[model samples]
Target: MFKLNEMAVKPVMIADAGFMYAAKMSGQASHYDLFTPDAGELAFLADEIAPHPFYTRGFMLHTDNKVTDLVQRAYEHENAAQYLLVKGSTDYIMNQTGLLFSVDRPSVESMEAIGGTGDTLTGIVTALISTGMNIPAAAYAAAKINRIAGLYANPTPATQVIEIINQIPRAVEKVLKEDHGGSF
Candidate 1:
């Protein structure tokens, strides 16, 4: 598909979280424009750096420098992404140049516990990118929007994904207002 779109006016690819597995297998991860991965998925990418499988969620959770090390290693790997959004307590946005920025706020732990939240983030980023935002900015803004939406919805163990999703407009509005300094 990438080859097919070589002539596209604005060639952009939005990789879903699972694309990491396929890219790892096909050795084509870095070919895409963007990739979204949670900590576990980030670990999976980092595991490719070593001959032995040493990355695990438990270790990532316990180690302070694990994410930084893993991201650096993964960014240098054969299939490293052009733009990567490592989703966790904080979302680390990176490129081949190295860590660009991270977005963490309205820390709703329930957002992590909920399924499809990452998919929602991908959707938000895709929309932003379609609007002419660069991959890095879109990912960063999408992370903030997703979290702000979660906060607006008051996410809890019982909260449904739709509830959080519904708050996206409010979140985007809030961000726009903040960016414009209280003006629309």
Candidate 2:
């Protein structure tokens, strides 16, 4: 269990594509403080993007499949996250001002087939927030750290989620070394 103290300034949110879908379906999608969705889920949010009075879906597979466009649309409408993290071949981090960052390196394509990876990302972001990191920065770091863990795990189609879990500390270490001059 977690406790909130009066000094706590960071707002923690943990949600994925499924929850976003259900919320949108129930007309409460915009109520979330944050959302972490993949490329396909970004498309789902674009269903109601501009020039339309009603919502639509599956347009992600259509000509509107561009991830950036979809993310922009979602941020504009759908009452989406004040900070949005879209996971995919290239992870995108966005806030109301516009795209904050995009992390695409140390890529492991097989990570897509691995289950619980997205959940791992949520955990990483939450932990960062608990330390009082702002949502957008936490999310940006989370995306890169999660991918670095996958690379450290050297994932294969047969690789299980545990391998990725085991490499998280090392991944964080690597990111810290690169970003903090090996002090962490």
Candidate 3:
């Protein structure tokens, strides 16, 4: 359902973080910048100096958590739930690089929760990351997908994981085609 270029890329593990899958293994993906920290580092520094012009009043960004701060880039206003989201964001970021977004998506067996969210996004994020996108960009892409899926999951009150998962690739592709071209 995508435009060509569907060559399969191997699934690299999160356990071994690297610029490229091979690099994490010891600079095997030497040709690529597999797992450099620069992506998140720049995002952090840039936001610190020239924070998003969009953030007003109650708007929050992920600072408490280093990884979420790097991936989320920005956080929308939340009332009582702010504390939990902040905690979750922080926990998620430090542990995950771009892969977590996809991993967090629900699986098909999710009855207690929506299903296949992760499965759907897994393919999308992995593909993009393999195609030379860095962890942050890939993470952002996956996060965007997750958000969309979240919205789709509920579309009323709370987001359902399934809806967000299903719509991720379309949303990601749109961003890729329209706004994202450079580094993460």
Candidate 4:
């Protein structure tokens, strides 16, 4: 979905908290499924509305937990771009850039507040998409790419978003040339 939309225009991250919870309970990883909504993410959504007053649209959710519906509704308004929720979330939309990446991972039980694993997954997606591979391939290559990125970002720092993006192009080239060659 994300990749298909990319063919048309840039995409807004529609995060459905309730839906996310369902996915989580159904065995989906919280990070890849439903991570916290952030400021940057909200800003991206706000930008989606050309004339402002951003109306609620599609939202694919996956989480073992969620906030309130009021919180979600509150985001439907002008200046919503500044809203924290829109700024920090994602979905399987094929917005302008197409399905950039979709990554899932395990969530820590009992512990809340920090979703480092989610961050790592998002980074993995970014790297895969930036590599110029197709959406399916990018999604498929996430685990291996993530493992390589993990080595570069270890210990104290842990999650390195840029590191993932930076390594993507080279990673894609290596994989394509070695495995498929002219097959594709």
Local accuracy of candidate 2 as per-residue lDDT tens digits, 5-61:
243653454568677777656655565667888766667776664222134554555
Give the residue spans of candidate 2 off by over 4 A. 1-11, 49-56, 181-184
Question: Which residue pairs collide in model 1, if any?
Answer: none
Which is superior by lDDT, 1 or 2?
1
Which run of 10 residues does model 3 get worst, by summed lDDT? 77-86
By lDDT: ranked, best first: 1, 2, 3, 4
What C-alpha lDDT values do all the predictions have? 0.77, 0.75, 0.37, 0.35
For residues 1-111, write the lDDT of model 1, one tens digit per residue: 566457656478667656666776577777778888887677777666433224344554455756678778776676567888888898888887778988878789988
Question: What is the model-wide C-alpha lDDT for candidate 1?
Answer: 0.77
TM-score of each: 0.85, 0.81, 0.36, 0.30
After superposition, which runs of candidate 3 have C-alpha atoms over 4 Å from their true positions? 1-11, 15-92, 95-112, 153-165, 177-184
Model 4 local distance difference test score: 0.35
Of 2 and 4, which scores higher on TM-score? 2
lDDT of 4 by residue, 89-122 (tens): 2222222222334333212221123234345444
Off by over 4 Å in 1: 8-10, 49-65, 180-184
Over the full model, what C-alpha lDDT does candidate 3 score relative to the true structure?
0.37
Tell me the tens digit of each residue's lDDT in model 3 across 70-134: 43342221101111111122123222223232233432222224444434444555566688775
